[model samples]
Target: MDLFTLTVVNAFIALVATGVLAMQGQADRQFRYQRYFLLAGGCMLLNAGISAIHFSGILLPYWLIPALTNSLSVGASLALAAGIHRHLQKPGKRFGLLLVFILLFVLHLTEFARSDINHRFLISIPVVLLLNLWCISMLWQHRKTELGKVYLAFIATFAFNILQFVFRTTFMVLEQHQIIQTSIAPVVHNVGFFALTAFAILVFCCIILLSHSQQRQMLQQLSERDALTGLLNRRTLELRLNAEFSRCQRNNSTLCLLLLDADYFKQINDKLGHATGDLAVQHIAKIADQQLRDYDLLFRYGGEEFLLCLPDTDLPAALQIAERLRLAINSAPLFTPQPYFLTVSIGVASSKDSQSWQTLLQQADQALYLAKHQGRNQVQSYQPTAAVSR
Candidate 1:
């Protein structure tokens, strides 16, 4: 097609690639393989960008055009091939395949150095065909798996590239033979190539949307979750608490925040070092996680401090839970090689009347502070209207 049309198509493909990369953020290892496919497809389209200049002010040579375009296409093909092997769970072969592609690239460049365009095309197309065949083979071998879906996706991708290659080759051969004004040019190649690019662009767009959707999901998960403990962070707790509070107010359901702090944490760090201390916290978090309901949100408020937002729970019930957790921590031995014992202090705060999530947190903190002041391993519950907001 014309340069303007080609440039627009390539630009569109580039955007699709970006979208695909973004979406891969939360994908499992297998599904994430599609990222490479879109990446390769994007690279191939970039080659068209060199010739499809919209600016009339710029000039480019015919020889430079085909050569650069061919390079990008080959490069893209190689990336896709490597991605296929990864999806197929044959990663050991990827390095070898990559090396082979590098050699082919070297051979193609050498042919170019010698001004042999035919040999360059000859060397490149077979590599692409082989790459696609390998992908198809991998898919066929794993036809019974959930991974089959990935293979089918690859098949569609391979067909698109093969079709694009055929159309491009036809036009190049015809143009080189001085057949520009022939009816076959418009009917068989020009319009046909444009249509194929459009089809390929659509395929690319689908992949991009898939990837972009994943990235957004991953970001959302990261926002609400603590990386180490797999618990809701402080920000997420506030949001969940607000929503829970509104629901509780409407239904007259009770809710509470249980604040827990590990006792003698600094001593653990000083004696066992930070690594063991981290493991201790991790162990306690695991124990706490096992004890909590799925609806409950746990937050690491800061160093050695955790908060649990309990919906539909009254102050008495919250205190019972706090006591249970306190006993659980105190009874459990240190889950490390170093000889030691660890305990935790827990504070429970229930809403007296209407209160914000912040007010509940302040009350819980006050109770926890009291526990620390009294001793180490103990559970303290805040009576309604017992103290002013700290």
Candidate 2:
């Protein structure tokens, strides 16, 4: 290969590798189907460099071509298949999908070794098209989404390159046996091969960029999740509740808030130290979380108090959940030296379309005062029309 050709291919590969590295650095989730974009992009760049070196005709054996090609092809195909399945929430279908590729690719390689690339192309071209079509079609189901649009672009670019390969591979082997006209075959095959390689790198790089954008979004969500309680932290709850409160006011819907404090939490702290206190709170949160529905928002409001927001849940249901949580805490002892028990006080408040979050919290606090007033371990509801007791 000429220096110019080598330089162009290497530069393109380097660009793809750079994109994959940038995406991997930004990946936030422990594992996501999109992260495979980074993994596969990096592999392709390295493989491209190897192929470019081989193109220079450094006297490698015939076996190396099919061997190396099939090896990399197997890996890339599997990665893509698994990633696509997971991205589409079809993980249960992964093995069946993978088996199709394995059968087609293995047969294609076996025919190529014995019968030459031209004969193999007769089998592989239409089959490869169908395989590629299947993968792209799956992602096309997601075209109504933003991320799906990204994968669609990937399929478009990749499908074009695969078609180019079928054409180029057919001509190269045909020219070898003088089955085609002499003059145009070499130029067309060389040009097509280089162009397909470049296009494939470009497609892989674009997938990396799209994956990185998605990863950033997940990172933002993760920052809002509480580590201990698996609930939204105070800050995220405040932001969400404020927005929900505004909507409730416009629509005249009821919004409820529950304030809860663990009774004698300080005793856990004094007797068992801060670690047990933390454990106690975490255990209580886990139990409380089970009683609420998925749409309800739970938060470690601050220190020993937890706040729960139940949209459309009226005073009665709010009080019911609170009391259930209160009793649940009392029934379970947090390993308190065989005799001690754990209990919590809960205050419930609900209003019809209250816009002010601050005032709603104030009312919940007042209800908590009523709970403390009645006794330490009980549930209380706020009544705005009633006079405040001194």
Candidate 3:
């Protein structure tokens, strides 16, 4: 299509990207990277609009026309670079943004505003190249994530953008010096126009795809984690337990499971409030986590109940660890509005020859029931009454 049509299309695409990113940022408030992406999209839309206006036959005011339009181009590039930096949780360099804008304004005032419209691209080329290169570096630094290939693709796209500007700048210089007198400049111009349009679309698509991937990761975490305590929820606990059990069987190694319940959790909720009860639950979970080994897996089995798996531990050692956990939670003071001590009753179950996950969980539950029945705030070990078939 013609340049005018292509300009309008770019503007439309940018505006749509802005709206979509804004909505995504609104929906996922914690992922602050989305806000940066939304800002980048807005700048892109503004840049495209400025480009379209500049292409029209109407004359704009001296200081407000090409200067602002080119500034927006710089803004679009800088915003994407900033968004990538934020996405990686890097420390901010707010002054760098101000410095860039100041430099761009200086160029606009002296060189760009006074020169022919054709020269503005020459001024913009280096700025765009540096910003795109910065973005590529950020993406490359973080290329080892779960979406490593996606990050690499983004880097490759930005690298191509950098090359486009590099070649464009070189051609502009060659033409200015009358290096090769021919109509080749127009051909390069047309190619550059299409390349810029395609690059804009690709950049927005990458941003959206990256946002979707991050959202999926966040949702997966939410599904598997307890919202209050941040421990693995029951939904994930079974899968983890099964995997650990199979691993232990194949390795012929010992493994232990501990089922822990906050003592008198319902009474705490009834006496205090659900909020305080939540605090109590969190306190117990924290204490339990502190007492357990780093490799051990902890899960919120149910309300006020946590499950822990310990690999390479025999029944005696598991009981000792369980007792230590029980003591730690019982001794720790939960300084709430109504300050009180928290306690957990933990039931220990160790792996046996040809034992299944179901049997281990059942044994732990029964042991926990016995611990609570005998008295709360203690640890009990599961002792099978009989040896049956697997």
Candidate 4:
């Protein structure tokens, strides 16, 4: 299609994108990046509107049209980059992006930029290319995170836009040097505009998908995690425990469970208030988390109890870990109204001595009873004879 037709189509697309993004931003106010994307869509719409007006033979100033359109185009690109940075929770190059727009606007005002279309293309397209590259780099760096794989679509879209810009730049250079036929120039320019419109659609779709995916993941985590301690909840325990149990059964490896309970948690709540009681639980949880290995799974098993699943760990090693956790909690001071130190009683049980995870959990619970029965601040290992005797 011709330039006017392409400009009209682009304007319509930008208008739709701006409206959709505005609704999305309003609906999901928590997604801060959506605001930046809304700004980008608005800028693109303005840019497309100006281009349509310029091509429609509306009488506008010689330099004013190009200046406005180029500045808005560059602003849209910068907004896209800013949104990506925000999505990744990275610091944005705000001052630098502003400087780039300032420089581009100044260049557009110059007689050099207004005198030739090629000069304008050379001035503005490279700025956009660099911004696109910056966005790709930011997304690439974070491509391994939980939501990183979803960014592949975004990266591919930006990469395609980069190539499209390069292609346009090449055509503009060849035309500037009088290497390409005049008849072919409009075709290349229209192709560039078409590519740009397609890119705008693809990138915004990717953003919407990413936002939904992130929201879904957050909801899933909230469902499976303890609200207070931020550890795995009992709801997730059975699934994880069964998996670990089967793995150990097949490999003949050991899987140990350390059932931990905060000592005198009720007293802290009754005397210092439930708020401090909550703090006490949090304190013990924090200490246990710090003392454990990365592969170990910690869960908030009860009001003031935590369960640690240590795969491939023997009973002796589990006991040592349990003792270390007990000591760590005993030493840590919780700032209460009165002077008080938090402690935990840990019960260790190994899968090697049990037929199933249920039996193992029972063994750990019985051992926990023994530790509390003996006194509140010690680690105890499950012994079959001792448990039977109890």
Candidate 5:
């Protein structure tokens, strides 16, 4: 296609992308990255519009067109980088990136207008190259996750764009040296230009896919998590316990279970109101989370109660962990409407003594009962003969 046609096509695509992304952002407020996507689309639209007007022999100042177009291109690139960061759930410093882009665009715009097309390409190259490289690095860091796998498309696209820029630079140099005498030597005539357009379309599709994936994840979390504490709910606990139980039995590996309940939780709810009571429950979940190892699984079994699954742990080790959890809860006072101290009674049971997870849970519950009976804020272990309070 000719330059005018390509520019118009690009402008149409950019406008379409902007509309799609804006609608997506409106539909799903959780994926804030869609806003950056919209920003990128808008910038690309502006860039294409300005390019078309300049190419149409409009009576604008010769320098002004390329300057605005290139600045918008830089803005689009930076917005893409910011979008990728937010998509990965990473902290994106948009203000800092915007500041840097503004400085670089100002520095490049004047010189870019005065210089030839090759110099303009050179000036724009580093800005885009650096931004694309930054995005590639961010995606690479999260390569192990499911979302990261989707990011590979982004990597390929950016890398292709960067490689295309490199080739365009070389072609520009050859043209400058009069090594090749061809009319179609500019970037608009290159194969890479079309490829970049195709990749831009692919990126929009990928962002839609990313949003779908995140939405599915959110739904899964809602189904499996406790609404108040944001810990695994009882349904999730049952599934995990069954899986862990089978695995332990097959491998002859030890596993431990602990059932913990917040002491005087009902009293707190009655005296301090449900709002403070909710905070107290959240506090227990937080403390328990901090005390456990990465391999340990913590679940909110029900209201004011939690269940923990510790793989490869024996009775003695489980007891120690339970005691540590109890003490940790006792040490930190929860911030309610008023400061209030909280305690938890924990029960420990090991897979070595029980044939099945149900048996283990039953034993743990019994031990938990004993701990609550023998004054709260204690860890108790299950004995086959009787519950032993520790």
Candidate 6:
């Protein structure tokens, strides 16, 4: 509508964004990026507050208003870039960012900047455009990641702000050079402020969507993974096992199952504590993970027990892999309050020998029982007649 009304709307939106980000920071203390976003919102609020005060016909020094508002606007943009950097797990250049703000503030105080509003826009808008471009480049670098698509809205909002700044700058220059009517300048300026208000709303919505998506992914991971060892849990294993079974059946390829159990895990828990026992299991899981291929899937089948799904592997290769895992766990030492040696008994079963994934798992379990029966810390292959030790 009008400049004063638009300024009031911008201030109200900034206030709401600041409050929401503050609550978000409190809700998730571990999300460090939220703090930076909160700072950005605060800067926006301060910038809008100054604009509102200036437009209200308050008697104030002429240069103070534009200089303070422009610097705070740039500070808000820099804060947004810093938040994005932190969200991506990158270190922020705090000193460099502070120095940029100082430079902008000092430049705003110059006679050249104070003499003409167009000069001030030329000085400040390019810096805002560059920060927006920097943010776009960083987000583009991670465009293929799991949350890449989620960043699209964020990127588009910044891109739109950049275009609005360019458009405002062009009209400001035209008004300064008498190329456009002076009346047209205020309308263009009002449109720019409106665009900024829309940008703030869009950015806030994108932040909410991004946070919701992240939390949902984290919850899904927790549901599908073992809380102790961070390995896939049995619940997820069933789905993956069935999928692999169907794929192998259609392609006539082999799928192997290796059932691994920690030897004397209860003894470690009894001698030390349950915490030490957890450490022992984690040690075994880590060693086994290091010994397996990238495509191999490891699952926590039970307490002190893990199951591995090896796709396109025959009995012989599966046996070799099982033996390698066994040796790796046997040699690795678990360092806890009391150091102890960890070992695992692995059983190998191939899809070719069984009719279904369940039967294959049963055969591997039987082979694992035979390995423990014979002695711990060994690998056994399931045969129709009997289990052969390897």
Q: Which model scores highest in lDDT?
A: 4
Per-residue C-alpha lDDT of model 1 across residues 224-336, encoded as one tens digit per residue? 88877777787777678889888887888888988999998999899789988788878788889878998887888887889888999998898988888888877778856
- Among residues 3 or more apart in sequence or in different chains, the pairs in candidate 1 whose N, CA or C atoms overlap within 3 Å are 20-208, 23-211, 23-212
lDDT of 3 by residue, 334-365 (tens): 88765698878888888883379888898888
Lowest-scoring 10 consecutive residues by lDDT in candidate 1?
54-63
Candidate 6 lands at a TM-score of: 0.89
Clashing pairs in 2: none
List per-prediction Cα lDDT, in the order shown.
0.71, 0.70, 0.81, 0.88, 0.84, 0.87
Write the residue-wise lDDT of candidate 6 on 209-287 in tens digits.
8887888888999999998889999899889999999999999999999999998888888988898888888888788
Q: Flag regions of model 2 displaced more than 4 Å.
A: 1-50, 83-113, 116-195, 336-341, 387-390
Error of 1 at 227 (Å): 4.4
Which 10 consecutive residues of model 3 have the lowest summed lDDT?
381-390
For model 5, state the Cα shift of residue 367 in Å. Answer: 2.1
Off by over 4 Å in 3: 1-5, 22-31, 59-66, 93-96, 111-127, 141-153, 177-181, 248-254, 266-275, 289-295, 311-324, 352-354, 366-390
Per residue, candidate 5 scores C-alpha lDDT tens digits across 1-390 of: 677777877889888988988998999997788898889889888888887776776766644567667778888888999888887778646788788667756765575546777676766778889999999999888877867767887788788878877877687788789888767675436465576577678778777877888888899989998889888999888789999999989888999999999988899999989998888889999999999999899999878999999998888998999998898999898876567889889988999888889999999999899888889789988878884555
Number of clashing residue pairs, candidate 6 = 0
Best of the candidates, TM-score? 4
Clash list (residue pairs), candidate 6: none
- Clashing residue pairs in candidate 3, if any? none
Rank order by TM-score, top first? Answer: 4, 5, 6, 3, 2, 1
Between prediction 1 and prediction 5, the one with superior TM-score is 5
Quickly count the clashes in candidate 4: 0
Per-residue alpha-carbon lDDT of model 2 for 1-390, expressed as tens digits? 553375357547755565755566565455466555454554455555556567666655544454444444444545565676676777475566456556654665574544765555555455545556767778778877757667777678767767776677777777888898989865785677577566656656655666665777667767997777767888787689898788777788888999999887888899789988888888888888988898888888877889989887788888888888888888877775554577888888886524498889888888887887778799988877755585
Would you list the clashing residue pairs of candidate 5?
A: none
TM-score of 3: 0.79
Report the error of model 1 at residue 166, Å: 28
